[model samples]
Target: MTTLVRELWESGYMHTQDIAYIRPDGYIKITDRLKDVIKSGGEWISSLEIETILSLHPSVADVSVIGVRDKQWGERPLALVVLKPNAQETSADDIKAIAEKAVERGIIP
Candidate 1:
């Protein structure tokens, strides 16, 4: 284990629990692992992707996406959101609508 850790450390990947790819330009693009992915109806969804999309909403201050068991889809994404400061009028439906728009835009499955 020590040797493996040393090898990873020497490679400069650090303690990231994510998969990544190196681009031709030497840019490293990190992606979520299978364990962090949400599988629903044979579609692979990234929780971080959902969170990123939700964070774009003007009223959204913070957000997290998790997988919940679903009777039909097997698993569904549940968004936990916090509203921005002084944004008292935002409702759950409003947040849902923002996510729906992201789906339409192909940002998230």
Candidate 2:
């Protein structure tokens, strides 16, 4: 029993409470972390999901997503992104378009 419990924790089920599932090919992929999720409008949003989508944009070099307080929704997602060296001139609308495309494709809600 002790060996089984230790193995479970070693398999990424402790501390940060990150969630993941094993693929049929025996690969572990993380879906989200409990402490990093954003709760907005009574819905739990995965910050990692948003970050992953945004990072796919050409201009984005790095990104972080967090929950910010909002009067109506209780909280909302806020993204902090670092642009690639040559992408310093990227506009907000351009960044938004990438996110919108992800939404349209049902990659994120």
What TM-score would each prediction reach against the true structure? Answer: 0.65, 0.64
Per-candidate local distance difference test: 0.77, 0.77
Per-residue lDDT, model 2, residue 56, is 86
lDDT of 1 by residue, 1-109 (tens): 6654464355675543456789999999877553567889999998888888888889999876766667688877777788989889988888889889989999888
- Residue range 1-109, candidate 2, lDDT tens digits: 5643454356665433556889999998988755778889998878889889889888899887766667788877777789999997898788888888987988766
Instruction: Kindly state the number of residue pairs that clash in model 2.
Output: 0
True lDDT of residue 84, candidate 2: 94
Model 1 alpha-carbon miss at residue 14, Å: 29
Enumerate residue pairs that collide in model 1: none
How far residue 46's Cα lies from its native spot in candidate 1, in Å, is 0.8
Point out where model 2 deviates above 4 Å: 1-34
Q: Which ten residues in a row have the lowest lDDT in candidate 2?
A: 7-16
